[model samples]
Target: MREEYELEVLERYDVEVRSTRRIRGAFFCDTDRGTMLLKETALSGRRALLLYRALSRLEQKGNVKVDTPVFTEDGELLVSSAEGSVYMLKKWYQGRECDIRQEGELARAAKELALLHLELADSAEWSGGAKTGIGANDSTVPGGVLPVGRNPLDEIRRHNRELKKVRSFVRGRVAKNEFEYLFLDSFGKMFRIAEAVAARMENSGCMKLFSESCRRRDLVHGDYNYHNILMTKEGPAITNFEHMHVDIQAGDLYYLTRKAMEKNHWKQKTGQLIVDSYEKARRLSDAEREYLALCLAYPEKYWKTASSYYHSNKAWLPEKCVEKLKLAVRQTDEKYDFLAKTFGLIL
Candidate 1:
């Protein structure tokens, strides 16, 4: 019923829908205005406006194509149905998801990401060292606003504690499963690596870097994996800025690099290609480089798998968990080698 109601919601817009197709959890509508997508959203009013504003700003930049939100006839970014369901429409593009495995595509995506950072920086520019478009309470502002920046160092420390907690939980289990045994086997080494990386990050002046970046109001595409990027004929059309927020811009690069490397089995050339392509547009400062290397050094995959296992059903463990554990463990050597050769770090 809600799905059918979505079409009615589109009537709020002036365009006449000629056809509608469902794909990737979104409705692709061929409208009189152009291609548009309608999808249900749980975004709060503030968050929805934030995304709309960010994408609108990006749309102004000629080269950066984004799926900016389309306002309703009543000048609302979101429209509600009879049952209180909310939906947002956007100007969609004709394209497919970027293929991360292809080297050329990967390189193009990296460069495109760097270009995006430049635009996000421009949109988030600060004046006289004072922030803009940010309010005391985000809900108070309707024009949309960027949130306060977060320090990655704090997150790293918290993750470290969670890693220990998961380890203790697994150790307390007398009748351990295969995943538990493997986690125990790798816990000591992975923990040491985590600690070393955390210590290095603390001393790397990253806090100062983060503070300055926040003052500058730098923004990152919070979720920058391949799925968000569309491979259009014009080029990579970056979409979905919902998770976009103020943070160290390099964090986005780190995420893209890590995800691509993981898929390529921690290939050194792949890592180098990504960094090189990104550096072509925006170069990483010394501190940013160190920050990125340390971030990649931590056993994030290992921690995530164990954390998932700890919180899931223990009696009937999924086989995929064991496979993921083995893969994470097996990739340690390759990951370390890529880190050392590509970033010149020996941890």
Candidate 2:
């Protein structure tokens, strides 16, 4: 199977494959074009090609250093595996992943992320139109103004409903494990946080602003953690756009900011620095600023822990789940502090 993939890449790109080794689901092959990484994705051929085109478009416009996929002999962007999986190959860029702890590195990453956001803010090239996972239910503003895009609060409401289900499941269990016990102990605090977040969205102009951003066709990395960033001498290169989606860029910005702050227990200083850095690249509007804080204030980690444990086989709870629940509880104050200090929230 390994040799088959390598041969396909070799014949397609016309590059000599010296050797191949597995790296993170993809095979890193030593080739004349430097180290080339070959990855098989579950995405259909059209979506895969669409993604390739988007990355190519970004690279060509000098918006960012996106590693472009190599074309096959037939001028196709993907190769097929024996089991009918799709494969993509691109140059294996040389650099270390961005370290969020290092202020300078973090700032650079934040700036690049902003630039990427700005670039994708209104990309006409991205054919993936405004995709609301659910139907676009109309939402009303204070003056009874109907926003143009989907109801943003629907997602918050949906998550809250899921949390309630998980809580109910944990309570109904015959013999609870240590993680379930921790969950039972922590559920109230988490529910309160979720309520607060929902309230913040309902009262604020968050939905209207996000609805406006929706019309902009802004793209998000979907998963924009530090690991996806490569610290090249040229600058930070964002890779792995397979998770890209069309959402209000604030979600991506919030993810990046939250991810950066989590390393330092939601330290206000670090959060401030990252937000400031991003602001320099592309300023966050009033709604986005407040919404980002609400996203942080939401007990996402706790919900994630509960959701994971609920979905898994309930023979026993893993030690890691307990540890995560504890971590979530321990960081609550710090998370609140970061939100309050950064956004001037009264909470």
TM-score of each: 0.93, 0.89
Over 68-174, each residue of candidate 1 has an lDDT whose tens digit, in order, gives 99999898888889888888999988999888899899999999999998887754432112465443233223355566556677888888899899888988989
| Residue 133 lDDT (model 2) | 36
lDDT of 2 at 80: 75
Q: What does candidate 2's lDDT look like per residue over 134-185, in tens digits?
A: 2233322121122233355777788889989988988997887788778888
Best by TM-score: 1
Cα shift from native, residue 12, model 2 (Å): 3.0
Quick one: best lDDT, which candidate?
Answer: 1
Reference-based lDDT, each prediction: 0.83, 0.75
**TM-score (C-alpha) between model 2 and the true structure:** 0.89
Pairs in clash, predicted candidate 2: none
